[model samples]
Target chain A: MIRSKIPLRTLAVLASPALLLPVAAADDYRDYRAEAMAMVKRDFQAKGIAGLDRLEQDGVQAVCNRTGNHPPADVVRRLEQDQMASVRFPADGKLMGDWKEGEKLAQNGRGFTWTDKPGLPVGGNCYNCHQISPKEGSYGTVGPSLYLFGKKRGYGEDIQKYVYSKIYNAKAYNLCSEMPRFGYIGALQEQQIRHLVALLLDPESPVNQ
Target chain B: MRARFILAATAGIALAMPVLAQTGASADFQKFRDVMEEDNPAELFEARGEAYWKTPSGPKHASLEQCDLGLGPGVVAGAYVQMPRYFADVDKVMDAESRVVHCMVTLQGLTYEAVTRQPFSNQSGTPAHVNVVTYVAGQSRNMPIAVPQRHPKEREMYQIGKEIFNFRAGPYDFACATCHGTDGKRIRMQDLPNLTRPEGAIKAVQGWPGYRMTGGLMLTSQWRMNDCFRQQRFPEPKYLSDTVTAILTYQAVNAKGQIYRGPGIKR
Candidate 1:
């Protein structure tokens, strides 16, 4: 194993106090928004699976961007309601899928880079931001740990639906969440989302254990 | 029978060692970086870059020896740290790589398209431009970053860059801020730099044109920013776009006065 880099990095930063000047005030150049957007349009080239359309910020995204992910509470409430309306539940009314498959998807963080092939199954990438299964040592702390989610919340249909919708479009519950609208963005299929829900709420899953 | 059983156990332990090693891989990688720093492979690229700067082979048969890198014509020392500053000649602020590209085009009579055609080095080989940047960066080793905000355009680029850093978009809803806006956080185990801060911002400026050990390819910050947007699931920003310069400016300005160790190796 390599040695700790934090101390070395810290020492380097400590070696230069005179050079660490305060950042320029960000008060001005709010007017650059239009120009910046224009630059984004001009400078960014769509390649492979990532299209120019990806740059198009929807109303929700625009609000989030403009507010620094801190839109006024009222705006957040309304936007979150709108987001909730966009979550399409499976007509079959079944929410949970195989936990084993969901576990695999959580562990798999590969997909959606420009180099990735289209039409392939996308991973849920749950473990990248949340702790779900106790066995996972490398889970990120971006989102809350969902370990024992079903054990704590119960294995009811309502909770299952909540988990399903949350995975599909997280902004429905909380606007400006770092969590992606996985199903809304068409990154995860309804069944894939269902599997994720099971991974969180299935009593037999490692998450509950 | 005992000998056979002992051999099987030893083999099993050997097989399990890699898993144990993976647990401490980050620390191991840091140790590897420490050891490798003394005899970095980046110096080889720096030497080649120096040669490229002096060599004349493009359509005009001119060398980048006469190229002005904001400091003045043909002055390579400490130039990397003072850019993405505004260039009066080009009427735009340029980072080290873009300036190298400009010189390759303007001085050597190469087309922008041709020079940047395979701008980044790949498995096949290191690009001339990437090496050029390495050489330029090497000249600025141990020099302070002074990314200028003296010119109106330079100031404007810094402001625009700040916006881009915080601007959230794409399938992931990630801005550069999402991962890098905070400290003591990691996507997995890899620490994310708080790019908004001085200490954190320097990380972005340091060690590029880096010799990436994984592919053994030399890469510049242009590739770094482009790849960041790609990983953010956003469309690729064109090579040497103002959007990128703006972001680089913001980081550099934040990191102003910090010492750049020049071209270094990466994991």
Candidate 2:
């Protein structure tokens, strides 16, 4: 009778909430999320250019999911400290790249959709959250305005390192930052990130002007 | 054989008639224009905005009724239609949102950091700053765009904005002009407005400081510009900076004579 009332899959989905108890609060929130994720996983069929692996959560994502956006301050600090260690600076200590190329990269939001090829590079989609150039009329405001980022911040060694690390792993600076880690996930190469640094920090770049 | 040929020709004509009719239907934007005229929700936002204008808030418990927006103090009507203009007080050209921030900081004593800290919402939550912007933009709805270009600084900014619009570089080798420079371009179901044309500029510029249904956020024109740069893979632009004002001026001036009907709703 119980089996008839609820399907096997539904029961499994409902039971997933108990798994998250030790990490997050035992409130109905985690339970509801687990049930929702189960339903999502069941319905989401990986087609061409999409894969089932996307449904799996990484360590950082799992932590973020459990904590919502505002995790404990100490926990965030610890997590960010660990993330900072993962940043890989260039071997020769070079951080700057061609601003022209970096400008091109910042404007592009294309790539990584299911329609895209797996081997091809993914776009940084920075403009989705930031204001980068003076010329662009259509920009989203999720992150801080990055215009004159180099000018206001100063084009110094500290600034260069900060920009490089920020692009490499935004979470290293702000634990729950909305910015994606371009270098961390290999979405952007070291050279590409460096170019972006130059785009932001170069005195001659439009950003500084 | 001759009879068969005639029948085939008549059949072809019948098939082509509907295609020709469909093209004719979209040849003019009468239907689209009518759809826009019927009920603009931005007007409703504007009404709420006007109420907020008179209402007092902040630590000083002051109302924005006396705030100046370049036209002089206490004028709310038609301000949105002529924004991203040079203001002598600030000594820099400001877009609508930035100018609002300046007024709020000066009149209401709200800090620029505080106003910008939570500029707009990508979610439903009001987020005080966005409420203020929504109200301001609403006051200018239905007014014709007349961004002042008399100042040398304003003209220089407009030129910079134009240069930026046409400057093409990226992996995709795309510029804003690549997709929006021409007439009749659509990505998926969304029709890209021609930023260069008067009609397109009005339709595009006015809708900003708009509530995006998809993102569930109330975005300012500056935010809109930032997103465009991001999609283009350009570096992030500053919020409400001179550059953004320049670009907005360029769009506003290009849309000159078109009636302002924004902060409109968008999909």
Candidate 3:
């Protein structure tokens, strides 16, 4: 009877190890994201144009990641308000720039990639999402067609402000908006964004005609 | 002078012949129908999407089984092919993705910001909204398009979209028709579909809400139009704005009777 009881005790101890295995595995998965983030921090080297800071998440991105881009209404509104506040309008009060320059910027979806040099102007990459001009045959349709942006919206001050703000900080309106915040991060200058606004809102521009 | 003129004429013909021959060869090679027949990766997205639709999610801990997809609610099959349609509940015309958002908000009780805030990938995560869109768009594959323009609102949107499509501007003097108006045009090996024609419009419109091979992004139809405007050097379109819906309505209505085959894989 003593030998049999000893065997039972050993079995109980052995069973304990097996039970802990699942818990360990669960912990690993829970920490997987954290481990990955740490690994990226250690391994990723920010070179010339590309900075390590790019990996850093802002408040909006942090919330977006946590909630999977479906944050609660109150949270989204708060975050969007914060983003809106970050937008700095031009001191000169000029919102419209040359449409010709804007056209060039839109078509040129270059810059900001690792291969690009710092200080060079980044392309708006708008064509990557919109159908603006009628002439360009190759255009992506990630966003809506703004062919008659000015004509349909009416080129009023309210429209101008909306266009300016939209280009400046798309996230201000839609927190998880796919449209890049051209002016918010300084990827585009005020002048460049203004030109973009003009390209869309100027009545004399071909978009209206 | 006569001899020189003859020499020039002969040289021109010599240069033109090869160009014409190359053009002819490419025209023969441009049959995308053959490529589409074998297998479409969009089918894969659809399968994954189906799994997601039935999967339980959200803080509420429920599946989207009760979610409505514009066919009298809780009916997802063949709904995507006829999207950008009018919805009385929202008092507006909504597209596939937008309608999905509506369901997520109304049925799932997820906030609009949460649903629309991120790009599809980020929103989708392990069980993401991207997969849901893929699943929804897949349901309409091979179904003939039949946009409901019977509604006054729908008709109005189509007119607005047509005006937007034809509106030309910018330094390049471009309109949507500039690149897509003609029957045969291409930019660097990519064929430009003439959206005016039903076949071309169906092919073009149906393929969107697709996975872009180049950027490795799952793009929606709204994103497609926005990208076109960007290329045209115009300002970006607002997310889910009426303008974008109008354009979608125009394309869908024009593509009436054509089968839907989308949320396609694109290069």
Best by DockQ: 1
lDDT of 1 by residue, A1-209 (tens): 00111123323322344223345578652566667788888899889988887777666666777667876676676667767887899999999999999999999887777988876597877888777898887877667889999999999999998999998889889888888888887888988988888898888999998
Off by over 4 Å in 1: A1-30, B1-25
Q: After superposition, how far is residue A107 of candidate 3 from its true place, in Å?
A: 13
Candidate 3: residue B263 lDDT (0-100): 68
How much DockQ does model 1 earn?
Answer: 0.33
Considering only chain A, what is the TM-score of each predicted structure?
0.83, 0.84, 0.81
Clashing pairs in 1: A1-B28, A2-B27, A2-B28, A2-B29, A3-B27, A3-B31
Better of 1 and 3 by lDDT: 1
lDDT of each structure? 0.82, 0.67, 0.66
Over the stretch B1-267, how does candidate 3's per-residue lDDT look in tens digits? 555455455545554686554244344343332254246565666677787678776666667778766687668888887788888887888877777777777766678888777744523342256678888877777888988988877877786676566544332224576567667555433557788889889867866767655555666777687667655444445566676777788788888898886666666
Candidate 1 per-residue C-alpha lDDT over B205-242 given as tens digits, one digit per residue, 9 for 90 to 100? 88787888888888899999989998898889998999
* Model 3 quality (TM-score): 0.51
Weakest ten-residue segment in model 3 chain A by summed lDDT = A1-10
lDDT of 2 by residue, B1-267 (tens): 555455455544654686544233232233333354345555555566677678887767888888777788888777878787888886777776777777778878888888787655655465555666788777776788898899876876776667556544322233566557766554322456788999888767866776655655666777787777555544455566555666677788999999876576655
For candidate 3, what is the lDDT? Answer: 0.66
Ranking by TM-score: 1, 2, 3
Q: Which candidate leads in TM-score?
A: 1
